[model samples]
Target chain A: MVQRLDYLKESPSQTAGPYVHIGTNPNWVEITGVWKDDLGLVLVGPETVGERILVEGRIIDGSGALVRDALVEIWQADAAGLHNSPTETRGTADPAFAGWARQPVSDADGLFRFETIRPGRVPFSGGGLQAPHVTVWIVARGINLGLHTRLYFGDEAEANSVDPLLNRIPDPVRRATLVAPRTERDGMPVFTFDIRLQGDGETVFLDM
Target chain B: MSGAYFQRDRDWHPPALTPGYKTSVLRAPRQALLSMPTTPSEETGPVFGHDVLGPLDNDLIRNFAKDGGEAIGQRIVVYGRVLDENARPVAGALVEFWQANAGGRYRHKKESYLAAIDPNFGGCGRAITDAEGRYAFRTVKPGAYPWPNGVNDWRPAHIHFSVFGHAFAQRLITQMYFEGDPMIWQCPIVKTIPDPAAIERLVAALDRHETIPMDSLAYKFDIVLRGRRSTLFENRMEGN
Candidate 1:
């Protein structure tokens, strides 16, 4: 066996804390002019293609209190099921789509919202195609490490049934936590995914 | 092209339900995490360009200065290379950092610390790694602050770092403690990590060679991200 050099272990994780906004989203905190605007604020341009949609949710802790200090980030493929990353060698993703966004929870309501297009099906490394989904990561003052999870469309029931990731969790009720039911408001499609950090109905977090 | 896949070492990370860190009580998930192979989603990530950064983005000392006065505190320069586990340089990675002011107080309104905040010090800065995976930033040394986690617990002087690796699977958010700081070993958050060596990796060593004469000292803190599995392991898995 060819011996590999002793790899360096990962550094310990710490909480993002209450002041996370100052560093991640300086513009939002009134410390203007970091850039024209904060990065990840706009994932789609006017020319971007696909069905426009909005993903919104509130992060609730085990105590049933809203986590106002939380920061939520999303990464998803473009409408064509392609990523706008250099590692993506399959096909070019939509140049207009940024493919990522970060949003701090609302101070008043602890709600995090993202405006973007519906994503297409992405291929799983093992074999079959995965249902169209958005990868969600969350961090906050009390969160020691960033939590990883997924948001699947409840409307796509057929696709959701056979999703490789969703299938990994045998319990139907636990699996349902990953799917977000869709509703329409003001002529816009909105998917509500409430992430519970602990207790019953807690979201299925992934270890990638 | 699908590259080699490597599983995250679960043992390397601290458990989510540590009681010493009082916040983990209600925040930690009660259930176990579902392990999954890396998909295209995990292999790819967003790309940032140099055009997005302002000229003084890496200089915290003057980036938020008011009235032509710089931040108050001991000046220091932090520099290091972002590398993968295989020792390969990770270029063009975004490194964002924030910290308390010299008096151990944050600029936020909720800060109850008695220490006064320096008006000139915004206490945050960012830098992008070069082609060689090297990134450097200039700022004042942050002060240690006491928190409500315990009766009287003080966090060591540290800077919170958020780094983006080439892949989404490699993204990491951690803190860097100053070398020779006794408070590092006593902090409840630092004690959560099971491995002493891993905790040591979080400490940045003072590098006198890089220090500017009569100006600012330098600290070197190299970061290592998850690496792609070797091709040999891939062939073995396929029973080649």
Candidate 2:
């Protein structure tokens, strides 16, 4: 017998509570000296490659109220369809791009924003190209476990049509919830992607 | 071009819509969760350098102290290892923690608890696991407090932990309860979990062996993250 120990079960998740900012982004809450700056504040520098774009959105609850306490994190590939991770076996991702950012929804506006380059099409594990998309993870006081979802570009209609993951959804109406339509703000490309926790037009939460 | 993938065990997690946890009623998704495979985006995560941590980043006792004052409470040392399901060490993982002070009061403006806040306790800390996947920190034993969830629902003393494994998919945010805390059974939030075994995994046992003599008691809590499938299975698929 190998005599290996049994695998340990995962720990139970709990709510992040209203003070999650104190731990994740202390500086945002005015607690200084924890770090020079909070991690994930900047995703791209001036030298980063690809189309510079901005992503903004709010997390709305089932009651149609904005969740001011929610924290949002995003992960995506670089413009060359490469990830800035050691696990990425493809070509090198943009050295200047971190490709990950965490932002807390502003208490005043209940909105979170990220400035980065448009991601390129990444390969689906099942062997086809996926639409250029950004993976989004959300946590808040009411949420016991973090919710997982993705944001697809509405402008990539041609690519979205054949995306393995997006096409898996049988209903086009539900699929539309994952697409963020592009709009211009002061000559800058902006994608507004709002996430609804429940009820009508609920986002397609992913189980990965 | 792809690596081994591990599926999340949804059954182990509490349902999103547990009514007892009042917040879940409105926040849980009504639609069934959609399933997907791991991608570069899911498998990759942000890398945090050690430069981000300061000298007192992991010592909550004096991290926020002013005028050389220490937090008021029973001092404790929390030690543990971050491991994968396969029992492999998950080194370089960032472990962030926060909790109420010894008086059961958080240092936040939104905290409604009437307990007095300790001037020396900020109640938050961070640590990066070593090559052995072990991490330790010193702090005061947090006090249990009441919440507005129910008429008299009181939460057990607990510390919140945020862990980041090598992959974004391995990120986890959870709480660690003290062993023998009867309130763990009474809390509506802890009740949401269907399995008692899973709940037990969240409880840290007192480690007398590791306790500092007359200095601080010790608690041990080992965290487990999702593991990758064996390479042999990937090889078989490639051959097929």
Candidate 3:
């Protein structure tokens, strides 16, 4: 197979702007502070009792087009269903559990792989419930236009059934894009998700 | 890599850091890293596009559709003010802007405005400095364009302002919103003007006889490139 590449002549790494890393948003600012993993974590669901699972995904823009050189940052609650809020979870003294995190850049295939334990269910406004998921942020072309979305356990059909945000996405296929993949691959339980940006197969984002 | 062959200097040399001072800043040596060339091309050719290859569907903001094409070599003036951190007037500074006309366009290929994508309005203009560091452009104002926000929203009629000498790292990229516009609140990047009259002050004040300072309809866009003082960070170990 031939590798697709930019014919700009010079290497992009040589031409890219300096200080491209302005900083991550507050959510991720809180994340890299604490909940981070050096090794890839297997994304486990309610059905699979995974001693080893690797949750991997590629984030695509609104047009379902791959943002080849994008950066995605994510952070979520641990498996215990607790957040790093002084009003909530402990580890307040420790610098790690900031409940925020960051990812520098996406790979050649526009893929970003995050290693983390399964997050627990969280509450939402108006009795609506947020499923156990990971919040994502995107920085592409050096501008940090914060993109907030979540990743949910697909194998957990019962949990997905009650999720308010997923239920409100309008289109079934569009809603399905938000679900994380859970299946056996190469002798390991692996969750594969391809997060889509705007238009079809996408998640919601705030104005901020 | 070819870059590795270049001579390396490990010595650290820096002047005493000072706040609100230009001497200390200009003296600051350029980084070892290659600096991108930002020189504006002085070539002023037949800038307006000519329908030489005939019109195509892929192109927008076609200026060459008519005879002799759109107005090229049109000279205009730019008038605007300068505001400090608290949005106060910083009387003496330099403000310069380079952009295409009302078509929301640019001479450069990499423009982000949608008006450039439109065939109707051709946006292009540039403003130079004045005594008060005020700047103005001699062109029709640009129209608000729609962006693909989660929900569709139109950007307010605005012009970008670039400022210099305010401080190091004071390179600000800001757009001016037309006065009395409702969309200002909805814009994600627009830091709201606390005062209702802020917009009016930013606009050309007709009664103040400051109306139309230079060339065509004047727009007084005072800018503070930097938000006052900020540190020029240098990484070092504890002892150093």
Candidate 4:
């Protein structure tokens, strides 16, 4: 059969290149990028430790098997919407920004946790900062999966209404799914982002 | 922080969002066969070499490759299936395989195959199958190694397979080869491993159905990620 090359162009198989993800480069080892230190992207004169958010998640197989060696990677902007990467320009003062981190292995329970300062307000391409959000990438069993989502402060209702990313979503419940509740810790703010990689509570992703 | 990414202030209300973001996808619980996340960790440690791979090692190219630095094995074909609770082809699933090229060696930089010193057939390759969800590759069996733990172990000649289903959440990672393959029998990964031959309806059927390729034999590997009835484990918690 004569193959229509155009159809082949549309096949996702053509996308067999190494998945471009936020965390974990090549093997699961090494400390690369600006997210290496405690304050990921919070520019608080080095004093504002930013919000404390714990990203607990699992790596279950299609067979529902938890692969222990699986590595979890997360990249997010600080509460100020500024990424730690040199690229992110924050409303807070700091030109040296780097917005990324890599957590090599999940715990024995297939769980992973990250302690980062709240992201600051940074601008998107056409608009202003995206939701105070983080992007997640789960690499286990040699398979690289990409997941992008944002976390909103629990009571940041005013922000949610005008949040560039959230405002685009028309649904209430699904949009609500994107916002992580804000919890308090030692007079500091915290957001618990428990990621469900697959099945029921699998996180919703951005079009990109 | 700029007010751009604002949550509702006392005077503000949640802005109206588009329907697609929240409505494009709905989630349901995955069956058991495909959901193997709740299993436990079983690592007996370093098993290097001693597993037999049918045709992969016999690569006529092997003769021209490095000496002493080699992994050797037989050319045998094994078969199996990956089905839902009702037993169906998980088609389009992806499988990956990694093993020492015999001689219990890896072609990675850490393993010493650096272009600076040497470059060998110790690299890794992957393959995807047809609608049958079946896959095959040409590779040698694996060997075990002695680590700090101090044990006479050999890495299994197992192939690591990662499958992404129709949905992003339906993905799974697993391995398969043979029952008698030394690694399969003694490797730590086999403890929780189910009986390969008796894996219910989705068992991989040896493809006696086709002519064996001469270059390097072939294997019919299939994996069942999810569905109900026959104890399939779908990570319904993640919303597959």
lDDT of 2 by residue, B127-224 (tens): 99999999999999999999888999988999999998888888888889999999999999888888888889999999999999989999999998
Model 4 chain A lDDT-worst window of ten: A7-16
Residues A1-208 of candidate 3 have per-residue lDDT tens digits of 7996321110001001111222112122121211132111223334432244456777655445565555455555545545543324222211233333445444357666655556666654334445776665453432312233566788778888887666766667766776877987787666787755544544454211
Cα error, residue A82 of model 4, in Å, equals 25
Look at candidate 2 and give me any clashing residue pairs.
Answer: none
Clashing pairs in 1: none
**Which candidate do you rate higher for TM-score, 2 or 4?**
2
lDDT of 4 by residue, A1-208 (tens): 9874321001011001121111112233221221232212232344544554554445444345554554454555545554333222333322332344445444357665566655555444344434455555454322322233445656667766776667766667656766777766676565665544446544444423
Kindly list the per-residue Cα lDDT of model 3 for residues B17-101, writing each as its tens digit: 2212222222122222221111000000001111211222111122222333433322323356555443445433433232345
i-RMSD of all predictions: 2.3, 1.9, 25.1, 19.4
Query: True-contact fraction for model 2?
Result: 0.67
Looking at model 2, residue A86 earns an lDDT score of: 77
The CAPRI category of model 4 is: incorrect
Residues forming the 10-long window of minimal summed lDDT in candidate 3 chain B: B39-48
What is the model-wide C-alpha lDDT for candidate 4?
0.38
lDDT of 4 by residue, B119-145 (tens): 334324334445665655555544443
Residue range with the least summed lDDT across 10 consecutive positions in model 2 chain A:
A4-13
Whichever of 2 and 3 has more lDDT, that candidate is: 2
